[model samples]
Target: MSNDDINARRREQVELNMLTVAAVAGWYIDTYLDKKSCRDSALSGAAYVNELLIGHLERFRQVCRMERPIFMKLCNVIRSKNLLCDTRDITLEEQLIMFLFTIGHNAVNRQVQERFQHSGETISRHFNGVLQAILSLSTQYIRDPSINVPIEIANDTRFYPFFKDCIGAIDGTHIPVFVESHKQAPYRNRHGLLSQNIMAACTFDLKFIHIQAGWEGSASDAIVLRAAEKDGFKVPRGKYYLVDAGYGNTPNYIAPYRGVRYHLREFARGSIGPQDAKELFNLRHSSLRNAIERVFGVIKNRFPILKNTSSHSFDTVTDEDINEPDDDYNTDERRREGNRMREAIANAMCDEYSIHTRRLRDRHGH
Candidate 1:
């Protein structure tokens, strides 16, 4: 062969040898480890998982952060997809439980290894395996936002018709995180706490339709939201999302009136009610937008990992199933149009509320 051809052949032989070595290394690692830090507990991870799953349904829910049925269903889905398999010593149940226990309780690898009676290497491997499986099933679990008005808005007397086009709510939250010292500046929020910014869109019933996570905590809510929009979060034609003023407004987003009384506390009992159309709109807007806040509360409470810092380098939600966000809409025009829509909706709601109030007054002879 020519000199150039001989070099090419040598390079190909080297690549083949590298692949062979890599395959052998992967197989050996899977089967063996060098003095792996092992945990020995009387209650093996498998036994503990079985006890929790078969003993009491409530206990399972408390530990797994999900009902027994849901947990089993998830296991079935992952196994069916060949995402996990039962090993000789550790069953698939143990694998999933380790993941759930860790994320649900914010347990570190050491804690998880202790509970499961497994080596740190095995624990981390299985944990990552289960996590990847769960992420793969995102399409089935993280459903699409319905284009139609949500039942909560459609059936509620106070919100129906007025918010008939509202399909969901959107908001951003800060999730505690750990980052390298060199990268810590971007992760620090205004309060000087390290965190990641997360923006999520959810239906009125508290189901997340889309999420944009992993932005630095210092990022603005608007910035995260814009990124989410770019990543396939779309508002249906003529549909809008309820947002706090901090989230900003777009043609498909209805932000509560700024510089007005918008908080639920400001409208509590014994406090003066909204006195004008603007205030009325702000009050109702706040009421509806509170759904996003509640969603965050429920999520953080359920996944303590989100509420606290992680032992790992960092964690982030991967919205792999979301589509590329469409940025075709003219933002300036959308804002102008959204303003007009808000004004019209406010006036219409004010008129109807006035009539309803008068009717109540007359019926009660107030």
Candidate 2:
């Protein structure tokens, strides 16, 4: 072998050595990446499990806004319905708790991630999954209103007999929303905030009977109602709902007389009772109609997401319905008769009270 053969052999050896070094480096980098990924996954899973186990039952309720039993029941329902299944990394309970935490507190994804010790992506994925699961159970949770008046409401003299024909009360409230620039004008309400006109109806028990949301804030209550009617808002031939002045007194819908004191607070000051026929009618109407307001208050309180405008797509329909009544009754006539009866009763009560007061005064000799 001469000088040329020797040089060629040396070059081949150097090339083989470099290739071997490169192969070893690649294998080390791949192993390090795989190990890091596994460790991260394990830590995330452990963190979520530890957080859930760290708190007492009351603490769970305080954070999740539901009793542990109710939470467990809901979890069982989800599992039974196959709405959500347990995964290797996150269980069904963790997904639900995280989602409830976000809704109950109106927390953002980042907040939920930090609380659960997970990545933003993981938090978002489970949040959306739980939301879809809840929506799927809407039909099961929402009930159809019965024709008979609920015993709880019927027993109350302030509501019964007078509200016998009233299946529920309907009203529109503004919920803050976000919209594109071109669409913002339509959603800007009287308060000059972008919002959605959410019209809802609720029974005496404060359970929602119907909801028509996603309407523009600028839309009038009457217009939205008309749209609802057009879209098959069922009102039995005669049963009606108590509504505010923003609605009209149709054959099946009763609105308080305009220019009359309506809200309960308005009658709280200086007056022992209603002053006139309109006032009497309004007093009764407001008392029954206030159920819907209370329902809204409870819902907003329980789920802060509805209280403020969050960065969510407003196009999604979040309307819910439960306990819808069947068939309509003679609403207009019933309302008129009920008003007269209510007025007569009020006067008689006031007169009786006055007589008792005079007797007491004579006894006291003041």
Candidate 3:
């Protein structure tokens, strides 16, 4: 074929695809505006196509500058179709954004097929590719902190009276996912369901300093921590990562001193020993390190998807639904088991650390 003919064919494909996508978008907009009521439509298939095509073409000229590949593809297809006639509908940018809105709202390939007049396979392929692109582009937003410690909390007064050097809080949480048989042994949690292990280090401002996702659910919090250390997450001079009892008592990983009362309750009720300055120091350290729990609460609440197990197995499901499969498999029992393991480790560490913190406090006093 001549260059002109090839160009003409490409343009035709673009027009056909955009009209299909716009039809799908219109159905989505109606569904959202209608508040999802039970309904059926009597509109003929041909009429629906004509109406959506006209609507898409009417707005085509205005959205030519969109950078999304899907939108650009739609615009080119529509433009090619328009070459055989006059007047364009739905500009490239509008078509792309509209397509995105459909994917977000509808989230089903069959729905896209019914509304946009494309095969389910075509919609699924296009949708998954676009979703990956969107995620890849947005990854730029999840940045690590530059200074490590925020300026507001850097001064002596802010950390004052209790501890002088504090940086970020560290914790680990289980992200539930479908059991991939190949990795089933490693991914299995205590309760027998599959999950992914994620360890995060967050600062007071909620910015993630370190986030490692995609470990097997069976992995321990300590394992994640060790991996983080191996990956070279720096523990800056004079600053410590506030951790709970799950991690062992090390100079780098500090925990509350046991048998010693903290500010809240350093001296036990039945203790026959005198309440002295040694007791006071342990209390302060425990009080200062509890911020990590709050971080876990906020994250799970916002992304409830993390609270549940994946609905489909990662091994069986396509890439588009991979993240969601983990949420579907979550059960109360699984959640409790995961929570218990994490807490138990933390408490055990605290027991060990309590001994160390008391010794250190006594040494500091001398």
Per-residue lDDT, model 3, residue 247, is 64
Q: Indicate the TM-score of model 1.
A: 0.86
Each candidate structure's TM-score, on Cα atoms with residue i matched to residue i, is 0.86, 0.74, 0.48
| Cα lDDT tens digits for candidate 2, 138-246 | 6677655677776655887655665576788889989888677887998899989998888887778888877677788898887667666655577765477878887
lDDT of 2 at 114: 62
In candidate 1, stretches whose alpha carbon ends up further than 4 angstroms from where it belongs are 1-38, 315-330
Q: Report the lDDT tens digits of candidate 1 across residue range 30-64.
A: 65664233455678777898799889998988988
lDDT of 3 by residue, 58-170 (tens): 34332222223445564465456442112143233333443453433423445545554444444444444444544454346555445444453555332442333456778
Report the number of the highest-lDDT candidate. Answer: 1
Ranking by TM-score: 1, 2, 3
